[model samples]
Target chain A: MLRLILKDILIQKKTLLTAFIYGFFAIYVFGVKYYTNGGFVAGAVAIGYLFITYAVSYDDKNNCHIALNSLPVKRIEVVLAKYLSVVLFGCIGIFTMIIDGFLAELFGFAMPKNYVAINNVLMVFGVLLVMYSIYYPLYFRFGAVKMNIVNVFLFMTIIVLPKALGEFILNHENNPLIKEVLNFIRNSPKSVIQILSFAAVALISLISIGTSTRIYKSKDF
Target chain B: MSNILEIRNLRKQYDKFSLKDISFSLERGYIMGFIGPNGAGKSTTIKLIMNLIKRDSGEIKVFGLDNIKNEKEIKEKIGFVYDENYFYEHLSILEMKRIIAPFYKHWDDGTFKKYIKDFNLPPSRKIKDLSKGMKMKFSLALALSHRAELIIMDEPTSGLDPVFRIEMLEILQSLIQDERVSVFFSTHITTDLEKIADYITFINDGSIVFSRPKDDILESFALIKGGKELLDKDTRKEFLAIKENSFGFEALTDNTDRIKKIFKNEVIIERPTLEDIMVYTVRGEIKCLDSY
Candidate 1:
């Protein structure tokens, strides 16, 4: 099963290279701009989330499921391998962003300190967990083709809703509950929030993995 | 004798077609030709046996083990080749073998190397770069290398040229020398099966039309040709399909002895070929009126 997973990764080496190069540069540019514009933490997390999502999309685009099934491995192994690969890629993406943040800091850019950078990593993990929760079931149920369409629709919603709501709440500045929660989160220690965020992401990832495994085991192909 | 594979009353229903109580058994070391037309439930039945699809109701036992309950153990001993190439486009033949070799406990590297050399497949060549025939040969080589007891192939010879088809059939014939291996090969090309199949199972309209030994199917069934005068209402009833013209009539029947006796003096009784049997049986015509 490890060999199978490695084979899948090796087969897409070219795509991986392209995603890595493009993601590194894109995140670097976003990081630099956000640091200059006073939103470095949010910007890094958002760009990291996008990069990981795109990386996961490569497997869906390639119909790796059918290729994996054709081998002698069990269906459960295939599902678990995919989830593990996603998590592996997520860690790599997060590590890349950390390196990007250090590079930006070295370049005399004004940005959040080390703890905020760590919090940004935690936020990226949370976003990836949410993305997996939404996409994994879609993939197992409808396959890659239909999931692509669904992913696009879901991506739009994820991007637009948070920004729209954030704008509305900030513009009104009159919703006491929203203000209180935001104030609480802002005042919470960075370490505590990071731990809670990582815990939430880990819980979601496990649930998604279980859901995908069950759906995949029952799949016809 | 232990049966290598046994399926009883297997049924699967789709929106357009359904396999109605299909059942057959293949003993160890015997080649079973699963002959069927398009949409005839041949692949469906094979999928059910492989546990690739869920069966509506039936028992599938492979190597004395229940198919669903022992799917992984059964799959370890079985090698399957789909109609289309299953390897990833980017994967070279060697890379594919490298990935697959670990899954089977009995994978023989020497045998795999031998097959690659025998098939003349370039180990470094990507699967997408190979021709259709080369791809099929690669798949066959992979299947044989795993020391599989039962190799299930779906239309493995459909698109190959006559030479390659013959070569492929010969290779399959040689693989069963151990007398411990069996093959269930599905193909519409009857000639492939005619040359090698120990037992033949004919499926039509999503059902098993006939299943028997190759010799029995050929010997018991025949094509009777004669003028319309030979084809009285009584003799015509025995034929599965009949074609009549102004000068003569040709009919197909399952019971060659009975039909020959009925029209012994008038009609000519000739041995039926597998192709003829398939065509006439599928057309669902038994009597011909002498009009044209």
Candidate 2:
């Protein structure tokens, strides 16, 4: 299983160089423009998550699933390895951003402070776990080809939803249901909000892992 | 338990085709050639045995254990080679082997190194750089180094040159000396099987036509060639298929004894090769008009 995860990383080693360059640029821009975006490391997390797509694309590029199924590993174990690889890529992303930030600071470029940097990495890591919990199952269920189509819709929604939601919130302040939900999130104690977010994401991720494993078990090569 | 692989009523259903009560067994230490034309369910049957695809009905046992229930254990002891390359195209041969080497407990690094040297495969060259035959050599090296008890190859020789095919067959033939390893090789090319396969399992239209020792199949089936006048209903019943042209007609028959009784000293009765049997079964001969 460790070898499987390592294989995913090894194949994408060259991409790590590009990721580092991108991380450095993002961190530099975020530091100069926002100064503090509360866990600006999320920026790097987004870049790192893209590599997971590269890993899966590798699998699809040659129909590796057939070769993988031929191995002695169980189908569930194969799913578990994929989930673990996603986390591994997340770590690689975080590491890349931090290393680039340090290098930039030494060269006298502005960068996020260490404490904020750590906080941002952890925050993005959590976000990744939640997002992948949804994404991995889709990859297993639809496979690489169909998932690319799904990815287009998903990315489009991500690009469009924020502005749309902001407008909806502003226009619907008079609506009782919208007002109540907004009040709950805005007025909740920090600890209560944290606990709710953690619990919801954790629950979803667990379900995602379970679903992915089930889908892979009977998947035809 | 004497057999390394067994399938009993193993069936899979697709919208257009379904395997019907397929059954065959390959004893330990012999190669069984799985012969069929395109879409004859040869690869489908192999896929079911590997549990790559689920079977709609029937049972498959590998090394005396249920193929699905003992999938990991069975796969540990089995090495599979697909028709085309399945490993990552960008990674070098060594990197690909690294990914597979750890899964099998009995994997031998020394043996693998030996094969890489013997096959002259550069460890650093990416899989995409290698020729089709070279890729197959890499596959075989991986399959062999793991102490596999059975090697299941699906059309491994289909696209390779004859020279490499013969070399590959030599490697398979060498493995048979172990007396514990078996090979289940499927191919449309019967000549490849004729050279090395001890047993032959013929499948057509998603069903088993016959499974017997290679020698027995040759002995049982014969080709009869004579004029079109020998086309009575009783005489035609003995033929699996009959082909006719300007030079009289030729027919295939498994009932060599029965046909001999009817066409004795009149028609040429000659031994049929695996190709002849395969072609006769797949391409039924052109029928003669019912001219009594």
* Model 2, global lDDT: 0.85
Give lDDT tens digits, candidate 2, residues A43-157: 4565656787788999989998889889998888888888787678878877776677677778986654553454466566676776678788889988878888776566445
Q: Best candidate per TM-score, number? A: 2
Q: What is the TM-score of each candidate against the true structure?
A: 0.87, 0.93
| Model 1 chain A poorest ten-residue lDDT run | A35-44
Candidate RMSDs in Å, in order, are 3.8, 3.0
DockQ of 1: 0.40
- Candidate 1 C-alpha lDDT tens digits along B84-165: 7656667789877887788788999999899899889999999889998898888888888888999999999888999989
Candidate 1 collision pairs = B240-B285, B241-B285
| Candidate 2 accuracy as TM-score | 0.93
User: Model 1, range A124-217, lDDT digits (tens) per residue?
Assistant: 5566567768788778888766676777777666656767988988887767988887887999997787688778778888888888888988
Candidate 2 chain A TM is: 0.83
The TM-score measured for candidate 1 stands at 0.87
Best by DockQ: 2
